[model samples]
Each structure stands twice: as C-alpha cells, then as structure tokens.
Target: ETLTIKTASKTYPLYIGKGIRFQIQSFIQALEREFSSVLIITDSIVEPLYLKEIESSLTDFSNVYSYVVPAGEEAKSFSVFYDILTFALEKELDRKALVIALGGGVVGDLAGFVAATYMRGIAFIQMPTTLLAHDSSVGGKVAINHPLGKNMIGAFYQPEAVVYDIEMLSTLPEEQWRSGFAEVIKHALIWDKPFYDWLQAEIHTLADLRDEKLQFALAKGITVKAEVVAEDEKESGIRSYLNFGHTLAHAIEAGLGYGKMSHGDAVAIGMLFAIRVSEEYYGIDLELQKFRKWFRQFHYPEIPKHLDAASLLQLMKKDKKAQSGTIRMVLMKQIGEVETVKVEDELILSILEKELEEVQQ
Candidate 1:
C-alpha cells in the first residue's frame, strides 16, 4: 500500500509492504529518468543483514555506492555527517545523484542531511528498516546532533520517496519493537482515540505486534503523522502537537547520552510524565495506573532512579520547543486532544521530582 505525504514544499509517496526494497531499482528508474549515481547510506548493524539485498536490486543502475556508519545514535553527529559528505564527494557524486537512506532514524537523519546540504541539496529516498523509523522516514525533517541538543541542527528537506519494507522488521530485536511501539502509542494518544483503545485492548506483547497487526499499526501511525505534517509542515503551528512526548524525551536522550536509552523507550517515559503533568495542571483525567501497567507489559524500561530532576531540567532547557528560557511542552487535554503550553521551571521541577519519587516507590 502507499500513502502520500503532502508537505508545503512537495509531496512524496510512502510505499509500505513486504519485500518492497527488492523493487527499489525499478522505482528509482521510474522516478528519475537520468541520475548520475545512487548512494546507499546504511549502518554497521543493517549492512550485514540487508545491504547486499538492496545493492543487488540496484545492480542495473550504475554508479551505485554504499557507505556504512556505526549503528547507533552517535552516527548522527557532525563528524559522521562530514565523513558522509566527504565520501560522496570522493565518489564523484553530484546533484544528479540520489541518496538512499537504508536503515533506521539515525541513517535517515544523517543521510537526509547529507543530501540536503551536499552541493545545495539532491534527491534522496527513505528505505527505513525499523519500526521507530516509520515516523522519521516520512517527515521532511532531517538533522545531525550537536553536543547540547538532539536534532538541533537540521532542515525541512523531504525525500524523493519512502520505501518501507515491513519484511525487514522480521529481524528486529524485541528491544527495537519496544522502542518503535512507543511512537505508535504516541501517535495514537495525540490523534486516534479508537487506535489508542485498540492498542490497549489488543496488543499485550511483542508477539501480538507481528504480521498484519504490525502493518496496520505502522500505517495508522504514519497516516496520523502525514495528516499533521500536511496541516503544519514546518512546526510553526499544530505540528508541534506531534511532539507530544518528545520535549522530555529528547532531554532524557541527551542527558543520559545519546544511544544510552532507545528514543522510543525514553519517549514512553516522557509520555507518562506528560500525562501526569496534564492531570496535575490541565485537569485532564488519564488513568496513570492502567497506563503504567500497560507500559510495563511492553517492557519499556523504568525511568532511571539516579537521574536528578535538576539535571534533566537543565537538559530540557536546550529542547527545540523551549522559548526564552521557558519550556513549552505538549500536554494532552484528553486522549486525541493536545496543546502546547509554557510551563514554569519550578512547577516542572516539582512534577519531575514527584514522578521520580513515585517511580521509586
């Protein structure tokens, strides 16, 4: 199946199915009649497993080269970004070339940035292999990491297409599923009440998420994201709602060090905190106990007991949603309803401390 993501700048097809990566060569050939080269940027973990299959599919296309970066959040760094640019230049890639981001969010973000800035931008494709990537691959936002913040350096450069082969997910570890499902939950919470109820009732374990169930959830999540992006592409308005749990999520990732915690896992914790804050300040009624129980069933790691509220707050100040020293968090008025609000530092600190204390208890 295919979904079209309509952004302010352009529209692109997100193709979802089994074994779709094998058809990428024909898709690329059909999309661009004449291209100079095709660069397949992947990661170490994915390279051994699926790179050769993708490379084989592109054998008919000439000047196809592969570049592999380390398989983790660290790959989304200035050094790696520069290295990819250098490699592309050394391989004689130009504006006519196409960049294929062939892994999860890290590869997508890094390679998309390389494509966006390399010689004033070029065409690129998203070949996402992970569940978490279902969100990142479709959105036009691309970036590399800075020391202080996550996704701090980036651009709104959409891809030529997104080829999501769900077959590739068969090899994903359980931890990866845990990581990806958090976004699925986030998507449901922010947009689809029915989906949220369905997930809560039907999905109880990793095994429950396989096959048709997994595909439906991914597509539903992607559809929610696409609709939001269509309405507000550059995050100047309603698009911020898509970041429902990301403000604290990004802080946790940066505070613990990138890759120390999976993005989805951190976001799961952040969602709980957002819900709690909503209950406390916005007078929203969310069943904290039931949500925590559901989260535990999914094996989302507990928020670390050692993380201090003050330190996390310091990191949160660097969040993209922050404005003039105040943090703007996306809080839910109800499931499927959310808004961004400017939260005071002390109240945030108080909530953080109370939440951590509860988790400890």
Candidate 2:
C-alpha cells in the first residue's frame, strides 16, 4: 500500500510495499520530466547493500554519478563534506543535477549539506536506510558536525522527495535498531501520548524492530516531524520543541564521544533526565518508573565514567540551545506536548551529579 503525505510546502508520495525497486525507474522518469541529471551520494555501509539496484534503475533516465563515503557519525565531518563537493565538481555536476542521499542520517546530512552548498543548492531526494533516517532525512536540516559541536554547521533545505523502503531496514543490526529507536521514542513523547503508551507496553525490545510496530512507529514519527516542519519550517519557535531530549542528548554524544553511546541511547538517558528535572521543578507527575522499566529493558551502554557533571555542563553550554552562555532545553509540560525553556546551569549540574551518582552505584 502507498500513502501520499502532502505538506503545505511540498507534496511527496511514500510507497511502502514488498520489493518496490522495480517501480523506482518509473517514479524518477515521471519526476525527470521536469528535471535533468542526478547525483547520488551514499555511505560505504549502504553503498555495498542497495546502491547497485538504485543505479540500475536510474541509469536510463539521466547521467548519474555516485560518491560513497565512510559510514557512521564520522562522515558528518567538514573534511568529508568538502571532499563530496570536490567530487561533485570533478564530475561536472550542474545546477540541474538532483542529489540523492541514499543512506542514513549521516549520509543525508552530508549529502544534503553538499547539495545545499554546491553551486548554490540543487534538488535532492532522500533514500533512507535506517529507521532513524525516517525523521532526519525528511526534515531539511542538513549539515556537518563542527569540532566543538554536533550538527553545528547546517541548513534548512527541504528534500525534493523522500523515498523510503522499509525493506532497507532489515539488514540493520540489533544495536543499529536500538540506536535509531530513541528518535521513535522522542516522537512519541513529544507529540503522541498514545504512541508513547503503546511503545511502553507493546514494544519492549529491539527484537520488535521488524514487527508491525515499525509501520506505526515510522508513520507516526514521520507525521509528527512533517507536521512540525509544516508549522515551523525554519525551527524559529515551536519547532524547537522537537529537541525534547536533544539538548543534553547532544552533550552526552560529544562528551562521551559519538560512537561510544549511540545517538538514541544518549537521548534515552537525556529524556529520563529531562523527566526527572520536570518532576522536580514543574511538579509534572510523569510515570518516571514506567519509563525506567521500559528503558532498562534495552541494553543501553553506560555513561562514560570520565565524563563528569562539569564537563557535560561545559559541553551543553556550547550547544546551539544555549543562549548568552546559559543552558536551555526542550522540556515536557505533558506527555504529548513540550516547551523550550531556559534552565540555569547549576540545576543542570545538580541533575548530572545525581544521575551519575545513581549510575555509579
């Protein structure tokens, strides 16, 4: 079955079915009726998996060139970003070329940023592989990580189309699924209370990744993201609520080093911390213990011991959420809603100390 999600700014169709590769050529042919050449940028991990099938499908319509980079969060670097630009230029790529990011978040971020910058932006498509990409690839927020921060350098350039094939997720490892589910949980906590309740009760572990749960999770997650993007396309105000756990979550990723604690795992811990602070300060009577039970059911890596409250606070201060050297975070007023509030630095330290204390013992 196929569904077309029409945002006010863009209307693109999402086709979800068994082995949909055969239809890719016809879809692009229909799109290419108004466009020209195509540029495909993917990652090493994904290039080996589904790159050939995509190239075969696109070979007939227009001249297509592919650039494969190293996978993981590592690719979201300035060096690689520049390299992709150089390669695109070397290929004689023009403004008419469409950039297809055919991998996960890192690939989307890198490729999308390149398209946003190269020759002053070009049309692009997202062929996402990871469940995490369902959120990142759909949104136009694309960029490379700065040495001092995560996704610090980026732009709000929306994709021309997002082509998701659920079958692409099957090859992802258990840990990879765990890494991406944090965003799923974020979508639920920030916008869908019932989805959050269902996730807590129905989906308890990574083993449930391939189940019918993904359809609901992916659809709901993308819908929440699409709705938020439609309302606040530039992330000027209400859109900041999407960063519910990401303020501290980004700090954890950078402080512990990115690969040590996957993005979702760190965000999970951050979400727990946010709820703890919310209860303490706002009297938000949340079901913290239920979240604790749900979280512990997964194999979350422990926070790195060397990362002290002081260091994490320093990292958080450097984050984009910080204003005039003060920390701010997206906090939940209720399960299905959130707010971006300015939080004092001392409170952040206290929470980190308490969390670390419990973690150590």
Candidate 3:
C-alpha cells in the first residue's frame, strides 16, 4: 500500500508491504533527484540479515556504501553521530548524495539527522525494519539521545520517502512485536476509538500480530501520523498529541538507562500512567481497570523499583514538552481525545507514590 505524506517541508510517499525493500532501485528511480553516492546507515543486527538485499538493488549506483552501528538505542549518541559524519566525509559523500536508514527507529533517527546536517541537508529514505518503527519512521522528528534526556537534540527533517518492508519484521523476537505495537496502541488511544476497539477485538496473542492485522494497524497508525504531520509540521500544534504517552515514556527510558528497556515497553507503562493521571486530574472515568487488564495480558510491566518518583519527576521536567519548569503532558479526555496540560509536580509525585505503593503491595 502507498500513502502520501504531505508536510509543509515536502510531500513524500510511504510504501508499505512485504517486498518493497527489494524495490529500492525502482523507488529511487521515482524520485526527482539523482545522487552522486548512496550511503546506507544500518545497525549491526540488520547488516547480516538484509544489507545485501538493499545493496543488490542499488548495484547500478557505483558509489553505494553502508555503515553499521550498534544494534540498539545506544546507536543514537553524539559519538556515533560524529563517527558517521566522519565516515561520510571519508567516503566523499557530497551534498547531492543520498542516505538510506536501513533499520529501526535508532537507525532512522541517527541516519536522518546525519542526512539533515551533512553539508547542510541531503536526501534520505527511511527503511524501517522493526514494528515499533512504524510511528518513528513516519514522523520527521530525528535525534540522538542526551545523558540528560532521550531525543534531546533533534530536528524536524522529513525524508524523501519511507520504504517499509513488513517482511523484514519476521526476524524480530516476540518482545519486539509487543514493543512495537505500543505505538499502534497509542495511535488508537489518542486518535481513533474504532481502531482501538478493532485491536481489542482482533489481537489476543503476540502471534496475532504477524497476520494481516499488522498491516491494517500500521496503515491506520501511519495515516493518523501523516494527517497530523500534514496539518501541523514541526509540532507547533496538534502534533504534540502524538506524544500522548511520550513524556513519561522518555523519562522511563532515561531513568532505566537507554536500551535497557524497549521504547515500546516504556511507552506502555507511560500510557497507563497517563490514563491514571487523566482519571484523577479530569475527574472522569477512563476505564483504567479495563485498559490495565488489556496491557497486562500483553505483559506490559510496571514501573521499575529503582526509578524513584522524585528522580523521574526531575527527568520529566527535562522533557521537550515541559516549559518554564512546569511539566506539560498529553492527557486523555477520552479515547481518541486528548490535550496538553501543565500537570503540577505535587499531583504527579503523589500519583507516582500511590501507584508504586500499590504495585509493590
């Protein structure tokens, strides 16, 4: 399936299916610009699995090259970013060169950032391999992690196109599937109640994710993201709705240490906490227990013991959404409805303390 993402920066196509990765040459041919060289930025885990396929497709391009970073979130670091820039310089990749992000969100962010800043911006494509990447790959938000926070340094640079080969996801472990689906769930929670209900009715086991339902879910999630981006590029308005669970999710990732917990897992817990906060702050019934039951069935875990409320609160203050020392978060008014609100520190701390005590008991 093909979806056109119309952003103020550019209008691009997102090609989704089983074998689209093999059609890299055809997709590149469809682009208006030609490149002097092609640099593919991938991770170690994906190098052995699908690098040759992409390379084979680009045999017509004599200047094609590849760089392999570590397999996880650690790949999104300033050091790795610098190393990639050095590699690009050494290879003599010019401003007219193209970049291909050939892995998950980490690779996408790192490569996109490289393409964005390299010689003042070059064209790049997002070829996402993992399920979780569906959300990250669609949005142009690219960045590396900072010791202070996740995605702390980044830009709103759109890609030339997104080539999502769902077939490549077969190699992902069960946990990866669960992790990736968190974003899909988030999309449903904040934009489409029908999609949320569809998921609840259709998905019962992790294996269910491998079926046709996966494509439908991805398309729905990506479309939701595309429409939002088209309407509000650079996250100046409703774009922040996409960060529904991300405030606490980012904090969890940073608190636990990057790559220690999967982004999807952190997001799952973050969504739960957001719902809890919404219930209290809004004084409305969000059906929190039902949501908790669904999440637990998928084995989404609780907040780790070591990540204290005080420390997480401090970390959350560093979140991009936070402003003037006030922690602003996307809260649910209802499924498919949300708004950014400045949550008080005391309420957050109290909720954290109360929730942690319940979990421990």
Candidate 4:
C-alpha cells in the first residue's frame, strides 16, 4: 500500500509492503530527476544485511557508493555526521547527488540532516529497515541528539520518497518491534479513538502482528502522521500533538544516555506517565491499568531508579516545546483529544517523584 505525505514544504510517497525495498530502482526512476552520484548512508548492522543489494539496485542509475556508521543511537552524532559529509565531499557529491538512508531512525535522522545541510540541500530517499522508522522516516523531522536534549540539532526537510519494505522488519529483534509500536500507540492516542480501540481489542502480543494486521496498523499510524504533517508542516501548532509522549521520551533517552534504551521503550513509559498526569490533572479515565498490563505483555522496561526526577525535569525544561524555562507537555483530555499545557514544575516534579517511586516497586 502507498500513502502520500503532502506537507507545505514538499510532497512525498510512502511505499509500504513486502519487498518494497528491492524495488528502489523503479521508485528512483519515477523521481524523474537525475543524480550525478548516489550515497547510501547506513548503519554497521544494516550495511552487511542490505547495502550491497540496494547498491546493486542503483548501479545502472549512477555511481553508487556506500558509507556505514556505527549502528544505534550514537550514529546520530556530530562526529559521524561530519565524517559522512567528508565522505560525500571526497566523492565529489554535488547538488545533483542523491542520498539514501538505508537504516532505522538513527540513520534516517543523521542522513536526512546531512542531506538537509549538505551544500545547502540535496535529494534523498528513506529506506527504513526497522519498524521504528515507520514514524521517523515518513515525517521528514530529522536530526541528531545533543548532550542536553534529543533531536536538538535538526531540520524539517522532506524526503524524495520512503520505501518501507515489511520484509526488512523480519530480521529485527523483538525489542525493536516493541520499540516501534510505541509511536504507533502514540498516533492512536493523540487522534483516532477508533484506531486506539482497535489496538486495545485486537493486538495482544508481538506475535499477533502479521500479514494484513501488521500492515494495517503500520499504514494507519502513518496515515495519522501524514495528515498531521500536512496540517502543520513546521510544528508551529497541532504537529506538536505528534509529540504526545515524546517530551518525556526524549528526556529519558537523553537522561539514560542514547542507545542505553530504545526510543520506543522510552516512549511507552512516557505515554504511561502522560496518561497518569492526564488522569490526575484533567480528571479523565485513560485506562491506565489496561495500558500497564498491555505494556507488560510486551515487556517494556521501566524508568531507571537512578534517573533523578530533578535531572529529568531539567532536561525536559530544555525541550524545544519549552518556553522561557517552562515545561509544556502534550496531555490527553481524552483518547483522540489532546492539548498542550504549560505544566508547573512543582506539579511535574511531584508527578515525576510519584512515577519514579512506583517504577522502583
């Protein structure tokens, strides 16, 4: 199946299904643009698995070259970003050059940022090899992490197209599957009450994601994201809804150090925390126990006891959504309805303390 992301910045296609990655040639041809050279930026883990195959598919199109960064969150680092740029320069890649991000979120963000800044800009495609990339790859919100915060350095650049071959997800470990579904859950929670209900009713375990059901969930999640991006391309308004769980999620990732915990796992905890905060602050029932049970079935890790609430609060204050040292969080008024609130640090700290104490138990 295919979904088109129409943002004010650019419009692109998201091709989702089995074996879509192998069909890169046709998609590249459909672009109707010629590239002087092509750089396939991937992670070390994906390099051996899919690089040669993607390179072979693009051989007839241009001088296909490959650069592999260390896999995982660290790949989205300034050093690695600079190295890839150096590689691109040494290879004489120009404005006509095309970049292919051939891995998960880290590679997509790093490569997309490189394309966004490389010589002012260049064309790129996202060939997401992991399930988590389903959300990160489609939206064009690409960036590297900062020591202070996650995705502090980035851009809202769109891709030429995104090829998410479901078959590529076959090799992902169970943890990756757990990680990717967090964003899918976020998409449902922030909008589409029906979709949220569907997930609660039908999806019970990782093993249940198969055939059309997996594709349906993925396409559904992507559709929500596409529509949101279309409405607010630069995140000046409703697009922040997409960050429903991300405020705490990013803080956790940065607090624990990136790569220590998967993005999706962090988000699962963040969503749970948001649900609790919503319940107490907004006086709404978000089925907190139901979500907790479901998360347990998938084995999401808990927030580390060592991550002090004060430190996390400081990190969150540095979030892009923050204003004048105040914390703004996306809170659910109800499932499918959300709003951004400038939560007081005292309230936030109290909730964090309670949540952290509960996590310890």
Candidate 5:
C-alpha cells in the first residue's frame, strides 16, 4: 500500500508492503529523474544479508555503489557523514545520482543527510529494513548527532520516496522488536485511542506482532506521522506534537551515550514518564498500573538506577524543543489529545525524581 506525505516543499510517496525491494527499479523509473548512479547507504550488519538483492535490483538501471557504515546510532556521526561524502565524490556521484538509504534509522538519517548536502542536494529514496525506520524514514528530518545532544545537527530535507519492506523485519533481533513497537504504541497514544485500545487488548507479547497485525500497525503509525508532517512540515507548530516522548528520550540517549540503549527503549521510558507527569500536572485520567504492566510485559527498560534526574534535566535543556532557555515538551491532557507546553526545570526535576523513585521501587 502507499501513502502520500505532502510537505511545504514537495510531496513524496511512502510504500509499505512485503518484499517491495525487488520492485525498486520500477519505482525509481516511474519517478522519471534519470538517475545516473544509485548509491545504497547501508550498515555493516545489514550489508551481508540484503545488499546483494538490493544491488542486483538496481544494477540494470544505473551504476550501483554501496557504502556501509557501522550499525547503530554511532553511524549518525560527523566523521561517518564526511566519509560518505568522500565516497560519493570519489565515485563521481553528481546531481543526477540518487541515494538509496537501505537499512535502519541510523543508515537512513546518515545517508539522507549525506544526500541532502551532496552537490547542494540530490534525490534520495528510503528502503528501510528495520521496524524503527518506519518512523524515521517517513519524516524529512535527516540528522546527525552532536557531542552535546542527539539529532542536534541536521536538515529538513525530505526523501523522494520511502519503500519499506516488512519482510526485512523478520531477521531483526528480539531487542529490535521491542525497540520498534514503542513507536507504534506512541502513535496509538497520541492520535488514535481506538488503535491504542486495540493494541492494549490484542497485542500481549512479541509473538503477537505477526504479518497482518504488523502491517496494520506500521501503516497506521505512518499515516499518523504523514498527517502531522503534512500539517506542520518544519515543526513550527503541530509538528512538535510528534516529539511527545522524545524530549526525555533524547536526553536518555545522550546521557547514556548513543547506541548504548535502543531509541525505542528510551522512548518507552520517556512515554511512561510523560504519562505519569500528565496525570499529576494535568489531572488527566489514566490507568497507570495497567499501562505499567503492559510495558513490563513488553520488556521496556526501566529508568537506570544511576541516571541522575538533575543531570538529565540539564541535558533536556539542550534539547531542540527548548527555546530561550525554557524547555518545552509535548504533554498529553489525555489519550489522543496532546499539546506542547513549557515546563519549568523545577517541575521537570520533581517529576523525574518521582518517576525514578517509582522505577526503583
């Protein structure tokens, strides 16, 4: 199936299906761009497994090149970005060349950034292999991490198209399943209560994320993201709502060091915190224990015992959500209803301390 994401700059199609990678040549040909070269940017972990199939699919159409980066968040680095640029240059990739981001979120982000900056920008396609990339691939938010914060350096350059093949997810580790589902849950919580209820009632364990159900979840999540991005392409307003669990999530990733923890695990923890804070600060009605139980069953990580709430607050201040030294966050008044609010440091610290204490207990 296909969904169209309309942005201020341009519109692109997000294609989701089983084994769609095989049809990539036809898809690119339909774009009518006459790409001179196709650079497939993938990670080391995914290279040996899927590179041959993807490269073979494109070889008949254009000169195909592959650049493999280290797997995980570490790939979203300045050095790696520079290395990709060098590789593209050495191979003489020009404006007519197309970049194919052919792995998980890190590869997508790094490659998309490389494509966005190379030759002042070139067309790129997203062929996301992991479930987490379902969220990262759809948005035009390509970025690299800085020493100070996660996704601190980047651009709002959108992809030409996103071709997500669910078949690739079969090889993902159990941890990747847990990591990716958190975003699915996030989408449900912030936009569709019916979908949220469906998830809570139907999806009990990792085994439940099978073919039909998994497809439904991914399509719904992408639709939510597409609608939001269409409305606020640059995150000046409603787009901030997409960062519901991300403020604290980013802090946790940066605090623990990138790649040390999964992005979904951190966001799961952050979402739980956001839920608790919402109940306290807004008096929103929630079944906290029930939700907590669901999280535990799915193996979402609890807050680390040694992670200082004060330090995390300091890191949050550096988050992109912060404005003029005030930290802003997407807070829910209730399920399927949320708003961005300016949260004070003291209140944030108080809530973090409370949540951390509960985790310890």
Candidate 6:
C-alpha cells in the first residue's frame, strides 16, 4: 500500500511492500520529470547492497552518482555531511538534482538533511533497508548527532517518497537484526497491543529475523509511524510519543559512545527505564513485568557496571526534551499509550539507581 504524508510544503508518498525497490524507477521518473540529475546518498554498507539496483532502475532517467559515506551510526557526522554537499556543489548539481537516500537511519538522516539544505532544500527519495528504517524512513524528520547529544541538529524535511523493501534485510548480520528489533519493540510498546502480543509470542531469536513475522512487524511499525507523523509532522504533539524510549536512549548511546550500541538497543534499555520511572514517579502501571518479560527475551547486552546512576542521570537531563533544569521523558501509562512527563532530577537519579542497578546485575 502507498501512504501519502502531506506536510505544509509537500506531499510525500510511502511505498511499503516486498521487493518494492524494483519500482523505484517510477519515483525517479517522476523526479526526473521535475529534475535533471539524481544524487544518491548512501553509506558504505548500503551502497554495495542497493546502489547498483537504484542505478539500473534510474538508468533511463537523468545521470546518477553516489556519495558513499561510512556506514552505521557514524555516517551522521557533520564533517562527512559537509563533504557530501561539497561533492554535489563541485559537480555543480542544480536545484533539479534529486537526492536518493538508500540505507538505514544514519543514511536517511544524513542524506535527508543534505537534501533539505542543499540548494535551500531539494527533493530526495528514501530507500530504507533495515527493519528499524520502517519508522525513521517514513517520517519527515532528518538530522545528525552532536557530540553532546543525539539528533540535536535536524530538520523536518519530507522525502519525495519512502520505498521500503523487506528483502534487503536478508543481507544484514544478526547484530543488525537485534538493533532493528529494538525499534520494533518500541512500535509495539507505543501504539500496538496486538503487535506487542504477537511479537512476544512469535519473535525470539536472531534466527527468527527472516520470516512472515518480520514483515508483519515492519508493516505494523510503518503504519503506526505514518499515522503519528501525519498527525504531528513537526513533532509538536502526538509525534513525541514515538520517542518513548528515545530520550534516555539517545543519552545512553551518547554516554556509551555512538556506535557501541545500535539506536534500537539503546532504545530498548531506554524504554525499560522510562517505564520504571513512570511506575515509580507517576504510579502509572504499564504492567512492567509483562513488558520486561518480552524485552528480556531479546538477550541484549546488560547496561555496563561502569555506567553509574549519577552519570546516566546527568546524561538524561541533557536530552533535548529537558526543560527548566528538569529532565523530560515519554512514559507509557499502558500498552499503546504514551505521554511526555517531567521528572525531578533527584527522582530520576533514584529511578536510575534502581533501574541501572538491575541492568548491571
């Protein structure tokens, strides 16, 4: 199915299906009718996987060149982003040039931001590979990480279209599966009760990464994300709920070093902590036992002993959601429901001591 998200500036389509990458030609043909060249922004890992496919698909259209940046979380670097724009400008890419992002979160964010800024905002298409991209790929949000915080600098630049093909995930390693699964967990926790139940009942090991179950999960995740983005394209309202695990998750990733943990893994721990804090501070019961039971099934890394309660709390308060010296987080009162709430620094520290203490244990 094709979902169209209308922002104030443009209407972007999201194509969700198996092997949809083959249809990328239609999107590029549409862009070609509107442009003169195609600039494919991909990372090292994704370039080898899908760049040629996109090249062949767009061969009938304008000329195409790819800028392959370092893959994984590191591609969101500002220096590398500058280099991409420099390369494009050196090529004398015009406003007619279309930027195609083919990869996971980092590639989407990096390439999307470049499209938003280059020539004061050009068009870009999203070809997402990882399961996690089901969420990041559809949303108009684009960004890069700052040394002090994750996603600190970003713009809400809607893509020309989000083309999601479930087949590309087969090329990913097991660790990438674990990373992507983290976001799937977040989707279920934030908006889908049946999905959460299904995930717990059917998905368990890295080996389960390939199957009908994964496709169902990805479709459900994209639906949830698309609905939220359509309602709050600028993140002023319900869209913030998508960050349920992200406030602390971003801090954890930053504190532990960006690449040490995948975005979803950091978020899994963050989701766990958000619930614990909600239970402690707001008396909101999300049935913590059931939640943790499913999350723990993933067998992800434990929060290191070196990451102390005080240190983690300090990092959390620096999160973008923090206001007036107090840390803010998205917490769930129950399955499929979430809200942004404020927590005192002392209370956060207390909750962290308890949660981190358990994670370390």
- The candidate maximizing lDDT is 3
- The worst-scoring run of ten residues by lDDT in candidate 6 lies at 27-36
Task: Indicate the worst ten consecutive residues by lDDT in candidate 2.
Answer: 1-10
Task: Write the residue-wise lDDT of candidate 4 on 72-183 in tens digits.
Answer: 7787888899999999999888999999999999899999999999999999999998888889898789899776656889998999999989888888999999999888
The residue ranges of model 1 lying beyond 4 angstroms of the native Cα positions read none
- lDDT by residue (127-210, candidate 2, tens digit) is 888878878877688989888667889987877767788888899988779878888889888888998888887787778766
- On residues 71-159, what C-alpha lDDT tens digit does candidate 5 reach at each position? 87889999999998998999998899999999998899889999899999999999999888888998799999887666889999999
Give candidate 2's total backbone clashes.
0
What is candidate 1's lDDT per residue for 171-233, written digit by digit as tens?
A: 999899889999999999999999999999989987898778888999999999999999998
- TM-score of structure candidate 4: 0.94
lDDT winner between 2 and 5, please give it: 5
Q: CA lDDT of each candidate?
A: 0.90, 0.81, 0.91, 0.89, 0.88, 0.81
In angstroms, how far off is 124's CA in candidate 6? 0.6
TM-score list, all predictions = 0.95, 0.92, 0.95, 0.94, 0.95, 0.92
- The CA root-mean-square deviation of candidate 3, after full C-alpha superposition on the true structure, stands at 1.7
Alpha carbon lDDT at 158, candidate 6: 88
Number of colliding residue pairs in model 1: 0
For each candidate, how many residue pairs have backbone atoms clashing (under 3 Å)? Answer: 0, 0, 0, 0, 0, 0
